[model samples]
Target: MLPIALVVAMCLGAQASLFLALTSSQDRMALAGEHELASTALREEQDSLLRLLKDYAFWDSAYQRLSLRLDTAFADENLGLYLAPAHGLDYSFVLDGQDRTIYATRGTAKTTQTALTALGAPVVRAVSAVRRIGPGGDPRVVGFTLVEGHLALFGVSAILPSPDSKMRERPGPRALMILVDYVDAGMMHELANRYRLADLRLTGARPGSSANLPVTLYGGEVAGHLTWSPYQPGTNARHQLLPWMLAVGLVVIFLAIVAVRMGRASARELIASEAKARHLAHHDTLTLLPNRRAFMERLKLREESEQAGILYLDLDGFKEVNDVFGHGAGDALLKAATERLQSIVSWRGILARIGGDEFAVLITGPLAREGAECLAQAVVQAFDEPFETAGHNLSVGTSIGVVFDNGDLSGEEMVRRADIAMYVAKSEGKHRYRAYDPSMERGRELTKQLESDLHRAIGTDQIYVLFQPVVNAGDGRTIGVEALARWRHPDRGEISPDIFIPIAEKSGLIVALGRQILREACQHTRSTGLDLAVNLSPAQFWNDNLFEDITSILEETEFPTHRLELEITENYLLRRPEAAAQVLNRLRRIGIRVALDDFGTGYASVAYLKRFKMDKLKLDRSFVERIANDSEAASVASAMIALGQALNLNIAAEGVETEDQARALRIAGCTHLQGWLFGRPQASSTLMAEIPLSRRA
Candidate 1:
C-alpha cells in the first residue's frame, strides 16, 4: 500500500505541474496576441488617415485653390469642424508650391492658427522634407513624428490635378498634410475599449517586462513603446485546479475514480456550439439583423400561415452622401438609420438590411391597407430630420413600398411587388410611401423593356429628333420650334420622351442620349435661321465633354449659336447651383440662349433665377391645365407670366391641349405656347413646312 501511495503521489505531482505549465503558456500567448492585434489596429488607423489625405490631396478643387494660394473658403467648407470631428483627424493643412501653409486645422476641431512655431522643430523638418519631393506623382509620406512631446501619426500627399475640372487651366502641384493622435493616454484608452483589452498602455519599456512592442514607421524609426502585462488566472480557477490535482492521487490509486462522467456535458456543449453557428450563418454581421437567407427562411415559414405584410424601404439621396463624404460616412449613416428603424420595429416584425441602402420588414399579423400606410408614414417621418453622424448633419429620406402577401404567392414575389411599389414612390417624388397594386407590375415591365431597348437605340437610326412648334400665343404663327427626342423600337412603335426620359435618366444613359439628340437637332435645324430649343438633361452637368460636345456639334453643322436655345429643368439647376451656373455662363458666352423649363414646378427662387441669367421661362402644364377652372391656378399662372415679363424673360406655356387653356395662357401674358393644340411632336422632316424648307440642311 505504501509503494502504491508513493507511485500515485508522483503521478499526481506530474499532472499538476503539466496543467500549470499549460496555463502559463496560454497566458503568454494571449498577451502576445493582444500586442500583435494592437499593433495591427494602429497600422490600420494610420493607413485610413493616409487614404483620406490622399483623396483630399488628389482633388481638383484642392489643387486649384492651393496652387492659386487661396484656401480659406476650401478650409471653411472641407477642413472645418465637420471633416475633422467626423473623421477623427487631429491636424490637416494645405501647402502651396512655396511650401507655405494655406490653411490648417487641429485637434479634431477647426481652429484659427495662433502660431506655426508650436509644431516643434522636428515636424518642421519633416514637412520640409515632404515638400522637397515636389507635388505630383501622388507621393505619399506616412510616419510617426514627435510633435510637442506627443507622438503623432503624420502623413503628406501631393495634390494632383483633376482631368475634368471646370477651371479653364489646370493648377500646378501642391501638397496636403494630415496628422492623427497616437501613443497618448486617450488614444490608449480608446484602443482598449475597441479591442476589449484590460491593460493596454503606452509607456517606457521596463526591465523584465513580459512584452515590449516598439511603434515603428516604414523607415524603421522607433517612435514609442507599447508595454503590457500578461493576464493572470482567476482565483476560483486556481482553487478548482488545486482540488483536481489533490484528487489525482486518489484517482491513480483507484482506476474507477479516474473514469468520471463527461459525456452528457460534452453533448450539451456541442449542441450549443452548433446552435450558435446556425444563428451566425443566418444573420448579417454589420447590422446584426437577419440576412437575406434568414429572412427568406422566416418568410417561408410565415407563408404557411395566413397573409403577411412586407415593407420594402429604399433610402433617397444616399448616393450623394456617399459621393461627397466617402464610404465610411455612408456606413455610419446606414447604421444610424438602422438604429432608428430598430426603435420603430422592435418585437413587431423582422427587419433586415438586404442591400447597401435597401431594408425590408416582414409583418406577420393581419394588417389593413390603412394600417400598413400609417406604419409606412411613421417610417418616412422618422427620417424627416437630418441624421447627425461623424460630425456632419446629413439629410436623407426613405421611400417605403408596402404590400400584403396572400397565401397564393411566395416570399420572393411579395418582396418583388413591394419593390415595384417602392420604385413608384421614388418616381413620383421621394420621401413618401406607396402601396403595391397590380397596375404597377405592368408599368415596371414596360419600363424595364424600354430601358433595355434604349441602350440599343442610342447608336441606331431608331432614335431621332422631333420638332414641335412653339407658336405665338396672340396669333397662329409659329415663332420657334422645340426639338424633342423620340424613340421607335423595332417591335414597340414610338415611345414618348415622357416615358423613356426618366428611364434614361435613372439608368445614367441620359448623357449619351442627350448628346445624340443635340447633334441630330443641330444637324436638322442649322439652316432654318429660326430659334431651336432642345432640352438638356441634368446628367449633362457631370459630363466633362458637354461644352466641347455642343461646340463641336455646332461647328460641324455650321449651326448659328444665336438661334439655339438650350432648355434646362429648374430641378437640375437648383440641385447644382454653382456648377450649373458655370455651364450656363459658358453657353451664354458661346451665344446660346438658356431657358428654364418646368419653371414653377420645382424649387424656383428669384435669387437662383437671377444667378442663372436664363433668357426664358416655361410655365408648367399643371398650372396651365387648371387655369381654366381654378382661380388660384389662374392667378399663379398670371403671376408667373408677370414675373417673367418683369425679369425681361420670354414666357412660354407648355401642354396647351385646348383652346381654352391656350386663350387663358395668352390672356395671362404668356408670349408663346406649345402643346398638342399647337402641334403634336412630329418628325423634323414633317415640320419643314412649319419651320420653312429653306431652313433644312
Candidate 2:
C-alpha cells in the first residue's frame, strides 16, 4: 500500500505538470496570435484612412474646386458634410498653396476657424512632411497623433491633380488636404469585437497591470497605449480540468489507467485542432484551396536567381451569375472550376484561389514558361463547356495573364504584372490569355491616365456631340442624323470614341457619359427638326434609372420623344433577353424608337428581331464594307436587308464609304445609308449648317 501510494502520488504530480505545460504553451501561442492580430488591425485602419484621404486629395474635381477655383460650395458639399459621419472623420481641412486654410469642417459642421488652431503643431508638422515629399514624390503623410489631448489618426496629402490631369504640369506650390479621425471608445469597442479581446481602451500612460500595445508615431514617439484583457487560455483550461482532476485524485489508483488513456486522447484532439486551425488560416474554406497568404508565401520562397512562371486568372461574368442566381450556385460553380483547374495543373504547379473569382498559378523549375502557357490554354478551354450547378447550366469564362520571372523581378511584382496582363486580356476580350510584355505596363499607365481624364470630361465642354447624317438610300437626301460622342482631350487632341468608350464602359463612367451625350444631342438638334438617333451603351441600358434619365433629358431639352431614337447593340440583348424585353417595352411606351445597332455582327436570329421589337437594323460595317468586294458578303448583306424589311424594320447600311457599296446596299432594300459616303461625323454646328446642302444634294 505504501509503494502504491508513492507511485500514485508521483504519477499525479507528473501528469499535472505535463498538463500545465501543454496549456501554458497553447496560451502563449494564443496570446502571440492575438498580439499580431491587434497590430495588423491597427495598421489596416491607418491604411484605410490614408486611402480615403488620397481618394479626395488626388482628385481633379477636388483640385479644381479647392486649389484652382476656391469653390467653397464644393468644399462644403464634399469635404465637409460628406466626410463626417459617413467616414467616421472628426475633422477635415483644406489648405491653399500658401498654407492658408481655405476650408475647415468639425464633424458635420463648418467651422469659422481660418486655421487649424485646435489641432496645433501636429497639423503643421504633417502638412510640412507631405510638402517635403512634394507632388513628384509620395506626396502623402499618415500617422497617429494626439489631437486636443485625444488620440487620433490623421492623413495629409498634397492636393495634386489626378494622374491623367493636364494640371499635373502646372507650376506652383500644390495645396494640401487634411483628414482626421479620432481613436475613441467606439473604435476601441470595434477592435474588441473584431479581435475578441476584452475591455479594450486607449491610455495616455501605460497601465500597471494590463496587456497593452504602444501606439507609436512615425517619429517613434509613443503617443498612447491600447489596453485589453489578454485571453488566458491556460487558466481557463486548468479551471475546466480541475473538477475532473480532483475526482481522479480521490480514486487515484483505481482510475490511473483510465486517466492515462483519456489524457492521451485529449492530447491527440488538441494537436489535431491546432493542425486544423493552421490549415484554416492558410486555405480558402469554400474550395479548400490555398489562399492569398499561402500563395504569396510560397511565391516568396522562390530563389531570386530562379526562373518561374506566374499565371493570374479572373473569372468573367461570375458577378452577374452570382447576382442573377444565388451564392449557392456560385459556390458550386467555383468548386467545379477548382476541379477542372486541378486536373489541368496536376503535378505541374501550385494553384490558389487568391480572392473572389480570382486564382493564381505558380510554376517553377525547368520548362516553367512552357508548362504555364500550356496550362493557361488548357484552363481557358476547360471553361468553354458550361458548368452544371444548382440546377442551372452556367456559362462563364476566364481571362488568364501569364508572366515569366526574368530573374530580376520580386514575387509581388511578378504577381502584379500577371494581374495587369489578365486585365488586358479581359479588356481586349474575355476567355483568352495574354502573355506579359514590357509594353503592357506602359499601356496600363496610359489606361489609368485616360480613366482619370475621362471622369473630368463628362459634364464639361471636353465631351461633345457630333452629328452624322443618315441619308435616304437611292436619293442621297439626309432624312435623319445619328449623334456620336466625341472627346477632345486637352493634350492628346481628338481621342477616338473606340478608345475612350470602352474605358468609360469598363470604369462604369458609361452611364453618366451616355446621359451627358444624350442630353447634349437632344439640346443640339432640338431646332434642327430632323430625326435624332443616339446610341445606348449596355451600362446605360441596364441602369435602373435609364428610362427616367432619358425622359428627363428629353423633357429638359424639349426634344420630341417620337423623333428621338435610342440604338442598342445585339450582344447586350442576347445576354439578358428577358430584362431587355422589359426595358424595350418601357422605352417604346414613352414613344421612343429603339434601333438594333451593328446588326448582323452577332448571332441575332429572326426570333430576336421580332421579340425585341426593334424599329431599325443598322447593318454592321464589316458586312457593308465587304458587300461590294465579296460575293458571299453581298449575298449575306442582301439577305439581312430583306429580312429586316420582312420584319417591317428600317434597314440602315453603315460604313458606306464608296458609291458601289451605297448602290449595292440601296438595291438590296436598304432604307438609310450612314457613313463617309454621305457625310462624316461632324460637329453639331457644322452639321446643322450642312443639313440644307445635304437635302439639296
Candidate 3:
C-alpha cells in the first residue's frame, strides 16, 4: 500500500512539471512569432519605398556635399534639415576604397576603423555589396562601400510609407544603424516608432540553444525567418510554473472528455433548434412556406457566388380567388398550393411568399435553369386543375419571371434585371419564362456608376459645367454657350459625359441633373451676359411643372429669357406629341426659344411642326454628312431649308466638317451652320475674346 501511494504521487508530480514547462515554452514561441511578423512588415515597407524611388526622379544634396567635403550652405541648411528628422545614431560617411572616412557625421571614434571590425563591418561590406548589385539587384541588403565613396543604409522595410508620384527631393534612407551591435532595444524602438508594430517581440525557438529567449531583430532582411530555428525549449523553462499548468491541463482534459461524450447530442439539438427558429422566422403562419426575407436572402446568396435559378411566380387572377371564395377560402387555397410546391421540390429548393398571391422558388446546387423552367411549366399545368378549398373548387393562373444566374452579381442587380425581363415577358402577354442576357450585364456597370455619381453629384461637389461656344454660321461670331457635365472622380480621375448621361437617365437622376444644369446655365448667362443653349431629353416633358421651374430659375438669375434656348430631338415629338406640344407652347409663352434638333431623321411630319411654335430647325448630322458627296442628299437639304423658310424657322445645317460643306450649306440658303469648320467648341471666355472672321455675313 505504501509503494502504490508513492507511485501515484510520483506520476502526478511528473504530469504537473511537464504541463508547466509546455506552457512557458508556448509563451516564448508566441513572442518570437510576433517579432518575425514585424520583420516581414518591415520588408514589405522597404519594397514599396524602393518602388517609389525608382518611379520618381529625386535629387539629394547630402551625397554631393559629402563628395565635395564642403561644409557649405546646401549641406548645412538643406542636408542638415533632412537628416535631422532621422534622429538616430546612424552617421553618414564618405567611404573610400582605402578605408578612410573622407566625411563622417559627428560621431566617429578614432578606434572605429579596422579590418572586418563590427563598426566598419556594415560600412565596408554593406556599401561594397550594394554598389556591386546596382539598381535591379537584390533588395535584401544594399550599400555602397567607402571604396566607391557612396552608399546609404535603408532602414527596415516597414519604416517606409507608400511612394509618392513625384519625388521633390531625396531625404536619403533613414536607419537606426548600430555599426557595432547586431541591433539593440533602442534601435528597435526607433524603427517601431517610425513604423507601427516594428518593435513587437515574437515567440520563436532560439538557434543552437535548447531554450527560448528574447531576440532583438535589426531588420526584415537579416531576420532570416526564426521559424526555421532548430532549438527547442529547455526542460526547466517548460516546467517553470508546474502547479498552475497542472490545474489548467486537468480542467482542459476533463472538458474535452465531456465534450466528446455529448458531441452528437449537442449538435443535433443545435441544428433542430436553429431549423425551427429559421422556419418560424421565414415562413407565413398559415401556409408554412418561406416568406419574402428568405426569398431575397436566397436570391442574394445565389447571385453573389453560384449559378442558381430564381422563379418569380405570380398567381394570375388570385384577386378573384379571394373575392369570390372569401379570405378563409383563399387561405386554404394558398395552403394547398404551398403543399403542392413542397411535394414537388421537397427540401431541394426554397419556396417563398413574395407578396399577396405572389410566390418565388429559389433553387441552388445541381439545379439547372432549364429544370426550373420545366417546374414552372408543371406548376402552371397543375394549377389548371381545380383547387378545392373550404368546400369549393377554384382555378388560378400564374406568370413567372424565370431568372437564371449569370455569376458574381449582387442580389438586387439580379432581381432588377430579372424584373425587367419579366416585365417584357408580361408585356408579351404572360405565362412563360425569360432568360437574363449577359449583354445587359456588359452595359450595366458604367450606367450604374454614372447613376451613383449623379445622385451624389450635388453633395460631393464633383459636378462642374464646362461651356463650349456656339458660333453664328452667318459671320462665325460667338452666339451662345452649351454646358456639359464633367466628373472629376477622386480615384478614377476624369469620367467622360458619354459614359454617365445614359446612366443618369436610367436612374431617374437625370431630372435632378437637368435642373442643376438649367440653373447653372441661367446663372452663367447672368454673370457673363452670354446667350446659352441647353439640350433636353424626352423625359424632361414628364415634369408637368418644368415651365414653372424654368421661369423661377430665370427670375432668380435675372437672365433674359430670349437668350436661353432649349433643344430637343425630333424623336421627342414622336415620343409623346401632345405632351411635347404643351411643353413647347409653355416655353414659347415664357418668351423662350425652342429648337427642333436632329431633324429629318425621325417622323419628320411637316404638319406636326405647325402644331407648336418652334424658333429653329437643326438639320440631322446624317443628312449633313450625306450632303457633302451626294447630290440627292443636297436636294434633301435644299428641301429642308425651303421648308424652314416657309415655316419662318431659323434653318441650321450641322456637321459641316469642311470649308466646301459650309459653302454648300450657305449656298443652299441655310442661315446658320455649326460644325468643326467654324472653330470647334472653345471655352466660353475664349470665344468671347475672339474676333469673328467675316464670310457669310
TM-score top scorer: 2
* Each candidate structure's count of clashing pairs: 2, 0, 24
Q: On TM-score, who's better, 2 or 3?
A: 2
Residue 128's lDDT in candidate 3? 48
Off by over 4 Å in 1: 1-307, 315-361, 366-399, 403-417, 424-452, 690-697
Clashing pairs in 1: 86-390, 528-695
Q: TM-score of model 3 relative to the true fold?
A: 0.38
lDDT, residue 577, model 2: 83
Which numbered prediction scores highest in lDDT against the true structure? Answer: 2
Summarize candidate 3's per-residue lDDT along 421-507 as a digit string, tens digits: 554454345666566666545534544555565677654557666666555666666566666676677767777776566555544
| Model with the higher TM-score, candidate 1 or 2 | 2
lDDT of 2 by residue, 526-582 (tens): 887789999888878877789899989988999999999988887777766887899
Model 1 Cα shift for residue 376 (angstroms): 5.7
Taking all chains together, the TM-score of candidate 1 against the true structure is 0.53
